[model samples]
Target: MYDFNSINDYLNTKIIGQTIIQYDNLTSTYAKDKNIFNTCPDGTVVLSENQSKCTVRFGNKWICREDKNIYLSIILKPIGKNLMISKFDVIGCSSVCEAVADTCNVECKIKWPNDVMINNNKISSVSCDFVGKSDDPSGVIISMVVNANMGTDEIDKINEEIKNSSTSLKIETGTDVHRELIIGHILNNVEKHYDEFMKQGTIISAVSSCIHNSAIVNKTISVMKRGKKTVRKLYAKSIDGEGRLVVADEKENEEILSPGETIIIYEGKA
Candidate 1:
């Protein structure tokens, strides 16, 4: 469980979560994004020990068992003209990768757009919500899930379909990790890079960090589009300044993708 006092004491961010609303359980952290957007301060954070209906990109349910992972959502007001809200996904992913590495001593990688991978399997998922009427929103919600103390046995019990595709910090490090440390490190890293993004108005640092820490780029992979059956096989060339994936198909045609599933193929074989 996350100790509110310990987390608050350890948090080093300037404004990422000065005001936090924490619960032992909830339907979902971001589920209250609309309810609090009107009065919540810029860095208000909503955290829960468990979520009954946690969701991810494309409306998929995220597994949120108690005391097993990091589940929280942060509220932020849009800053700078060049600050694309989309870049926060990269920021979150990079921050998690760094935090996990720092705390667990196991290297993790980002899988384009947002998923964080450990040993070629997913260990974390990042999602964002902007509930305003227009493209420019008054507030933003950044939600994240990290598989922490959920041991290998627990992970093995997940839906058989994705059971083998996901992992946890305990599974990676063979030890029970302190959740508060992970959360504190993530908040600190997010604050550090977020300030840089707000100042530069671009994701240059985020793109570089993600590209360096990513495992999917430069690898032949399969891309599954949302609500569609068609899939594309491409080489993930890089993550552009705007956070779009730059990829090239077999025909040498270059294209950028958004909102798609990336499956890294094995050595260009299938």
Candidate 2:
């Protein structure tokens, strides 16, 4: 397992007094573990190298890739209103995409709710779980898992199974990258965005500007409903005050979607 000190030391130079923890493996989901530390402090991060079997299962496949990606969860205890937990998923993906874009110069676009894609391929997948009392909904535990190791061969195999639906950094950048460094950059960016959201009210002007400057806006998208076989064409109307995708249909009717529902933004017109 990597040293927690090293992770903290690296982050300290970028962010002051950010608390972090490391684990060899975890038996529970990142959300479950984060809740255990919910009341701790802000910027408290818990990282595990390997996770239990149950934690790896996502639908039909195991989300764990062992040494291939950064498996991390963070607890960001923000004050004020309990912002929509769903928006954090967008914040997380946009942060990762910005970090990866800076490092690799690959055009990264966020696929609706929580996947990041580069050159029409998927480079990262993000998930978040929220735990807090209704009376005081400010406490939130957000966890994200990113795939940094999916290279050409892995992408080819995955594409064969799923058919042009997924991608990785190695395929777009044509080079191997360090998962830890990417994780650190992603965390930094996420912290910056989260801070901005807290300070600025969630009006369309403020939130849309942040998301547009990041790479999720103006992309043609397809929304994949949970348990459905087909994907639908939808334009990203705007990221809501809470960060959910406010997408529109061919008729320009808008719909607010939950983060758990699968969404894929196509690189080309659907």
Candidate 3:
């Protein structure tokens, strides 16, 4: 488990992760009710060494390994009307990607709907949703779980159970990194894009950053329509302004699929 003082000392963000809260174990980081949320200021980060509960974006069990991974949530209060949770999905990926690169010297890919992968094996999973009552001091919680330092056997087991194949910082780099440092880097990267979103009030830049680090973009990959196992081969052109995936075929005919309706798989070559 990472120390509170270490994470706090390492973080230097403006509006994200300004307050670091850690627990020895919890059901979930963002599991608090409306009353607790009302008291917590915006940018409060919640973390745990062992999570006994909760699911990711697709309702898949986020397998928590004791002291082997990083699972945390950053709270942002007073979400604006009609906020697109999709934008935050990619922004979370961007933050995780940048953090992985910063701490582990590893490049990552974005599997649609918030699975960050390295070599087609998942390194992180993200989720965002409005917490607290709509009428109260509610806000969006962007939660992520990074496979920071899990061992190979534990990583392998979760991979068989989860949709994406799994890998960890320890597995990929053959090294165990200080999880606290990675958390700090992720907070900083998140704040960078959060500032842009607040200032520009747009998803273009957020989508662009995710696209740059995209695993499926500009690649010939397998596309499985969400809710069914049926998969297709398509050329991923890019993610559009609305964060929808733009995929094309041999003759350049294109189909834009919403994140909820599409699942992408990266087959090694073509």
In TM-score terms, which candidate is top? Answer: 1
Q: What is candidate 2's local distance difference test score?
A: 0.62
Model 3 stretches with alpha carbons more than 4 Å out? 33-35, 132-138, 156-164, 228-232, 249-253, 265-270
TM-scores of the candidates are 0.91, 0.76, 0.86
**TM-score attained by model 3:** 0.86
Superposed by TM-score, candidate 2 places the C-alpha of residue 104 at a distance from the truth, in angstroms, of 2.4
RMSD to true structure for each model, in Å: 2.6, 4.2, 3.2
Model 2 residue 141 lDDT? Answer: 61
Compose the digit string of candidate 1's lDDT tens values, residues 27-131. 888887567888887778888899999778767666677978889888877553554545788888888888899988998888767688888788888887675
Full-model lDDT, candidate 3 = 0.78
Q: After superposition, how far is residue 107 of candidate 1 from its true place, in Å?
A: 1.1
Q: How do the residues 1-270 of candidate 2 rate in per-residue lDDT, one tens digit apiece?
A: 655554554452333127666776776446545556645576667777766642321332334555666677767666765566666776777777778877777777666565676655555666665565655665666566666667656655552544365555666667777666676677777777776666774434325534664444555576687778788887776777777767788998888877666545454521
Better of 1 and 2 by lDDT: 1
In candidate 2, which residue ranges exceed 4 Å CA deviation? 3-6, 12-17, 28-32, 53-62, 133-138, 153-164, 201-234, 260-270
Model 3 error, position 238 (Å): 1.0
Q: List the residue pairs that clash in candidate 1.
A: none
Best by lDDT: 1
